[model samples]
Target: MPELRITTLIDAPLRTVAAALLDARLLARAVRGLGVRISGGPVLFAGATLDGSVGPVDGTLFVTRADTTGVSAELVGGPLPRFTLVTDLLHTGGGTMVVDSVEWSSPGGPFGRLADVLVGRGLALKVLEARAAAVSARSVELLSARVVVGAAIIRDGLLLAQQRSYPPEAAGKWELPGGRVEPGETDHAAVIRECSEELGVTVEPDDQIGPDIPLRADLVLRVFAAHLTEGEPEAVEHRAVRWLTAADLDTVDWLPADRVLLPALHPLLT
Candidate 1:
């Protein structure tokens, strides 16, 4: 068996780096010679599989583990069998540190071992390097882009939604309580501040709900799961406020961006 490891430092937050690494499309682009397709859950989630082929050689990369810290996967039917890959992301002083490790066994006996040393190592190294570069570029893009935060405050199996009252075209549409992330403010802090200003309440933000959605060329929308900590909510800046059950999601005319998140929001209500 032979093992190879590569480490890279990305000038981006850990969250941004993790998001890029977990992206199926980005991973597919990183792979060479193979046309990969996602079959089951997300690429990073356990039990997910990436089915593809390298020329005539069929390959299936199975995700074995995934978490905030790292991910582990194995390729069983490719040109390299019993090929294992593990990636770890750590928060460093300057940015995020990504460590990738790969292990594989040669197929034949002496001849196979010789080929692996001469050719296989180079191929594997190139693949890992390409993947690292892809992640780095994606993370930089996310880091430089502006972000809008939306808070999904759920209580008693009901989600809070607000109606807009300004900007004629969007006046009657519904949306979550949130706004732009101010300079030097974290997403969680922005969520707390926005909810307080618009809804007149204090909220504790939790994990993100869904993917980061593009709002404009320079802005992206991210929704977070939240809970009330103090004060009852009132529509201070909007036309109205309502607590809705999962089944009631489609009843309102949500703003396009918020509407895109309905499927991910439903699970929080239950």
Candidate 2:
């Protein structure tokens, strides 16, 4: 087995870089080779598969892991016998340092080993450099994006949900109670404040749940697990509030952003 590593610095927080790295389209473009246009993939979540081909050399990029820390993708059914790509992100001085590492094995024994030493290694380096460049450019655009924090307040196996009353399009659509993170406000503090203002209840926020959902190029939505600590909840800002069991999650029309979190939300209840 042979390994190649490349490093770069992106002027963005680890979260921002992590978000950018999850973009399947970005990964496709970054890994494109020799006029190849890679396509066909899901949202790049962990365990997702991206199928691509370069002149009949087919490969499936399987995402083994993805998180705030980094991503690991294994390439199977390609020119190489084994290929695993891992990206490690570390917080540095006001930015993040990214390291892209690829471990691979060439097929066909001696001749193949010689070919890899001569050509494959260079091609792999090019791919790694391209991926780093793409991520860096995308992360810069996300540096100032605002985050909207949603609280999934659960009690006795039921999740709290609220219906929108304003904005003609979203009226009656259900979503978690939340709003944008104020400038200089931490995500946890924003979660506490939004629940208090929208549900009229005090909440103790726990860890975040689900992948960060992008609402727009400049906005992202994050969900947090929380519980009531003081005051009963009242629908102070929405049309209605309901407690739903995991089985009842799909019964209501959820806002598009919140709907994407259903998979992650189910585990908290069950």
lDDT for each of the candidates?
0.76, 0.80
Candidate 2 residue-wise lDDT, 123-213, digit = tens: 6688788899999997887776789999999999999999999899899999999999999999999999998899889999999876566
Clashes of 1: 0
Runs in model 2 lying further than 4 Å from the true structure? 33-37, 40-42, 54-56, 109-119, 152-202, 206-215, 230-270
64-100, model 1: which lDDT tens digit per residue? 7554566688876766556677889999998899998
Q: Single out the weakest 10-residue window by summed lDDT for candidate 2.
A: 34-43
What is the lDDT, from 0 to 100, of the residue 107 in candidate 2? 73
Candidate 1, after superposition: displacement of residue 98 in Å? 1.1
Best candidate per TM-score, number?
2
